[model samples]
Target: MKIKYLYIGALALLSACTANDEALLPAGAVELKGITASIDNGSGASTRAVPEVKDAIGRTAFANGDKIVFTKIERTENAINPFIYSNIPYEYDGKNWNRTTTDPEKIYWTDGTSFHTFIGYCLPSAITTWEPDDKGVYPAELGAGKDEIDFSSLSEGNNEMAKEDLLLYCNKSALAASDGVTTNVSLTHALSNVRVIVNIKNFAASAIATDTQTKVIDFKLLSQPTRYTWGGGSNTLSVVKYADNNKKDIKLWCPQPDGEGTAQSKTFTFYGLTTPQNETYHGINGNNQPLQFSFTVTYPDPMNPNGSPLVKTYQGAFDKTVNFNSGQCTTLNISLNHKDEQMFLGAEYSDWSFVATPDLGELRKKSTYMTNVDETAIVTSGQVDNIDDATWLYHVGKKVYDIYGNDGESAAAAYCITSSLQMLAFAKEVKNGNTFEERFVRLDADITMQSSATAEDYQWKGIGEGSNVFNGTFLGGDRYINRLNGSPLFVKLGSNACVEQLHITAVGNVTNGTLAGTNAGVIGGCKVIDDVTLSGTPAGALVGTNTGTIHASYYTGAGNLVGTNSDGDKTGTIVGCYQASDITSFTKEFLTNFIDGTDGENPTNGLNDDLNAFYSNESNSKKFRTKFNYTFTPGSYPTLKVVTE
Candidate 1:
């Protein structure tokens, strides 16, 4: 019999010799096969075919012209197992398994009749005491039957055919044609022909084994014209020019199986835009896993198409997590756009936070004269033409009217014209048929009286005869009779008559007669225009005897008199006699010093003599004497003076 090896070494050697530039074989170039083999020792051997093996020896080394046969004449003892089984299948033709030997004794070879082995010694004759090698029996048969073999049908010295062919044929007879189908014979198939296989010889006795796996990937793409859009019923894919032709767009979707052997019902929804899209997947499981999608959008230039133009661009990324159990979803948003057609109302007045002025028309309508007037009936009225003139007249009228009806001559004169000439100059009409004489006469004159001058000097006629000298005789000397006791005078002075020198002297021992009584005084206390002088005992310059009252009288450069000395009883220069009456005297310091010695128990003879000489030397001694007496009242009476000097 001819002996042949499967040439597993050739597969490894071919892969090592090939360059990296070679192309990978197509998917159909790779195939999977099933195989069963047996091992036998002289004493006993076990044999079984490999389970789940496809094409059982049909595509392997024991097929067609290639065959593997071995025999051991003797059995050996004390050997160890040398073969290892793996759950994942080996890719033999691809050189995926390492072939370098750690021990030369573990490697074996044969040249038909002669065998080289690693684990046991072979005897030339059969012996019943034979033992198996480490991998079981000698020569280690690998199949249970002749047809249970796989092949690697590859062409000799053709490196491309080794990568592209799953089965190798030695001759045309080894390839058989059945009907129109062709079959190749080889020892082993190309590595690409083998399907991924897994074997589980023994499961964990204490625990059940299970597997779980997850994978996350990020996808990115630019715009593409041939992209397809799914979902939303029959909407076509949106196609637009993006960037230049240098970048091509790509899109992706995933299909999920409802269960094993069931058609995938829902295709994963995805989108590819005219712009670039980026997506990121996170987390182990789909639940609560974040998925981020990003895109860049470029708006066309409204002003230009082919040339350089203004463009509004947006680029951003967003992320959201999905809850599988609750079906809760979240999305992030970012956008930029122009919106110009919005309107808004300002805050209402009631809702405003600050104070403002009310409308002027509203305030004006509520204002009136009655509401703005004072208790005195005074109003703002309007601006006047002459404020200063109006104020002057207002103050003048106020001063003239005392609350009572008492007359105020000085304050009244400030408001109106006084003299007849002034009245005639301005007064248009007079009331009550009153003449200017009555209305505008000298209301009153302030006059000083003297005692030395005779009645003719004052244009007054004396009354009575002889010592009383009768120019025109009258009962009182110089004063009006109203100032004295109630006695009517025989002679009356003229209304406008002036009075000057008037004096009175004592007759003899006139005790009961009163001078200047309430109705018969020589000088009236109420109204007197002339001075009066008196001498000797019981003489008074003002009145012979004051029985009523006299007030507000002054004398200066005067001529007037009343009363006379009667047995040296009493005398006064200002008043001839004051009986139980009050008098006030005023004197300047200079005048008081000049008349210093006039007051004494007995007046100084030099002072009196000097005064007499001064009086007698004057041409109007009577007027001068009384005037000096009135202006400087003698120190005999109590006085109050408000004088600067």
Candidate 2:
């Protein structure tokens, strides 16, 4: 197959052809010559099939030299041989596609034999054998390092990008040998371009030190065809190998050894986000196509410095379907707010742009299902769709002034709290005269409150304030609330309200000496507090004036775990719970009213793997069930387990 240099007019090529015609008087034999290539000058990657063939979107000159890989397959009336001829190297010097080796397979111009089909692809890629699938589609592999073509060069007609452009050419029809005749082969782009950009924002102060050490686990594009195929009777390029989650369901016959006695032909090159913009190539095109692209990014857990690494996953359905030509480019822009753990997606699709928008949920992290604000519009309805996840409620409302749509916690909805900002808003809402009542609140991520612990009287205003109290259930969801201070986390809790599965870590100045102000410990006042754990040195004095119930909890601080109400009867229920023996043991705090105001049983030493002070095991949590009129909810794991010595 040959194509004319559409741009240069390759006047020299014309002269060369004239010279060849002067002596090509072979009878009954067509001397195939003047074989060159040209490409479509539409919006896309350039073509470099023929030297000076600058029609490549008007941006290429084939300066790298005109080297084409041609393939010729015999054609019969019936079955087409899947593998007849392949990867025949041909060099074009402004005139003809001269075969690198003379006397290669030749098709005679006899009428009895069907003519052979001729096809050619530009140089710069590894040539593979002509192997067609059952559907007669020929697979194309751009291979590694061939992810994108750099079209930044603009030196009049010398585009460095032409070296990486992939152009395929197929003759219009099979021809029988006769007198010297010229055949034109038009080359077009065989791959589409995809550009991706991610912008990171609002990371934590310490995130830089920690996040840089993070590692990627696995990267995958769900349902993406691994193999691109073309020529299933037609010259249309398409995708194959729709795969499973691991992309291993449909295997291809890629026989390259992986050095481990296995084939290293599973998927295409996987790029990392080390840079700003990344471009990928594709062959699949359609409307309403389903795509799921995900990469595992490990970042430091903002709350737990030594805990587990946090991971983020990006998932699918950019649109119902997307229509694109072979040379089109698709761009995807992703913005991630690390502080809020939010992901926002945007897209642009056009002849000079891309059509990819990560839609479905409002700027929420789909990895942990952290943000689900249910209400009126999922995104716009002030009636309900919240910040996406337990979003930043701190900015949502002000101190005791913003109700945040809290018409009074109806049992129908539960607001999500993923950050300290949102938690602050909830606390203010309670003080704003909105008792949670039958409603609920969920903690999606571990929250670390920031405050000036150096202030002489630095105190956390705490959750419930003034005459307002948290009356609804606070579900901690096995997460932690860090940096508790001198004041109790909850200033007050209503009789029926509950706080459970919660961890309170006091890293600094929870209490300097005498437990702060009026009847305040780690928790100022509470009714039902269960499965809660308090840890860290200088831990806040816990549960001051607890006249309610304290069940199966652990307090490992050096201060008082529970204090008796100085005003009311020194009475409260502490069952299946434990406190640090190094401090004033909690068991002796009440001691059923110590006869000597000091005499008490030996401090109970509850031991466990984590805290070594507890109420988490079946024995500690369930043994007191019959004694305190409490019972486990069957199969639920005990939040804190204790073993006494």
Candidate 3:
């Protein structure tokens, strides 16, 4: 909420520096002024307002005694990538920047050919910064956390939070080195500001009639990956930090005005964040939902209006995407009613605007990297663990009909499975028609399914079936799933599903199923047919039927990779289908699709990203791993080796 008493004004320094090469020390001075076009107010200070941007959310002028931290990186003899001076202390004396720290290093131009980069930020009392890295990105080591400019302090009320607004700036063009040339440093917010408004209306209190007294008790956001490690300079955010706190108070963390709403409605804001480009919210907590939260409200008991008010809780979920751009203000309007329903009204850009591009980490639980996972999430079956919905996930005997049974899923989106039980738990979800969609399940270690063929032992059924399909992605990551007991490791592989680089030794098929019914098998987005079993109903190396597209994939075990089944009798009504590479038999052309490692060819073999089989290391001649964590020899029979990035 933008309160006039709180967001009256903000301080941003528009600075410029000119350098001249010195024959002696190569020293230069880089000065900063207001944001205007050198419009000196007869007092030697420029005004802070930009003429083009009117109706600003907050005033853009210094209140004197303000602090601005600047850093100068000198390029001499190609020395430090971004170094020389750190936090060149400067304080605003209402009109000019004065020194706050003693003897801060001065800017020195090396030569006309050499260059110097400048980095700066304002409102030092509310934030802090670190030295830049070799790539000119500050805090050489990033993604650690908000130690430099912690966002946690933002829990304070909007009035107090206003003082901590962060204004960041880094000169795109550096000063000519070895010379005292002037360079301008304009401080603008690198994070986007979002104002949230929640309106309460018609309630489930209808049972209590007019005597119902509805009141708000508590509120918290329910959104996935709302925050992540922040980065400066060229490096955008590449990692994630989940928003799982049940009590994270909402407050403006960036420079933006706030407004107070009525009792039925409340207002708060969040900042220090940007959305990643071309990506969607697919994390475990809140899949593709935006501006969501959990709220608690109370009303008079229906039995007696004077009785203690009955308490009720509500959850928010939306089919929305959060793609806010950098350096802008966006407002999110939400409405809650007595019916315990929520409506999200998208985003409304505020008066304070710029190129707002939200940049955050990948929220999708697609293909996971085995290491550096958020261990806590893996233990709780991810965000769904908090959802009270029995249909969200459950156990077979406990609640078998739920969308899926959860045994393990902490960071399910990207958590790696290390045991056979974990794999079984995930498969149970797939069996219950979870779909998984774009999620990724990776095996960190070899998973051994039921070892003995006994009716007493719960035989591991294939990952999916006619009613339920496995539509997510699977990355072997150089791991294996051996001794599989499922008739086929995966049944009814969904159209969008894929698997590769997983070594398996089973007594039956490796995989089977026609994509989503319309005669699908060995498709465009599917790969691999590893060690197989010889005793299946139709019996094959890979699948029982072939209908979809199969690229440059191969199988070494005895028997055809795909069984000759065209009728839909099995489960899928054999629709239009094709196999670019069928392996009932191999030929020179089949071999031709894969060039010998001697020539050094791309493993995809002219196919797109979906094709990855019979991998060969052309350069090494011997088996080697690709960035995809797969290693295999280039000959007729390729044995998988430990793969690494």
Question: Which portions of model 2 show Cα errors greater than 4 Å?
Answer: 1-32, 38-89, 92-97, 104-119, 133-136, 140-166, 170-186, 201-220, 232-289, 296-319, 322-325, 350-645
CA lDDT, every model vs. true structure: 0.21, 0.41, 0.41
Using TM-score as the measure, the top candidate is 3
Separately for all candidates shown, the number of backbone clashes (residues 3 or more apart, or on different chains) is 92, 28, 64
- Tens digits of per-residue lDDT for model 1 on 431-514? 112112211111111111122223331211112111221111111223222111111111212222112322222212222222
Worst lDDT run of 10 residues, candidate 1, spans 347-356
User: How much does candidate 1 score in TM-score?
Assistant: 0.13
What would the per-residue lDDT of candidate 2 be over residues 1-645, giving only the tens digit for each residue?
000011111112231132322443333444343444566534234111111222233223343346666655334333323334565666666545555555454422223234546676664324334466877666644332334322333244443333334566665355542333444556655554444444443333332345534433343334443344556455333333322221211111111111101011011112111111112222233323354455455667767879987877645344434333455544555554556676666555433221111111112232111112232222112334353322322223222111133322432344566545456556656666767676667666666554443332123566666777776766665566655544456767666566655666553443321122222211211121222233333332455555455554545433345544343554455544444322222243333222112334664222122121223445434222112111222222122422231
RMSD of each: 66.9, 29.1, 22.4
- In candidate 1, stretches whose alpha carbon ends up further than 4 angstroms from where it belongs are 1-443, 446-458, 462-518, 521-539, 545-645
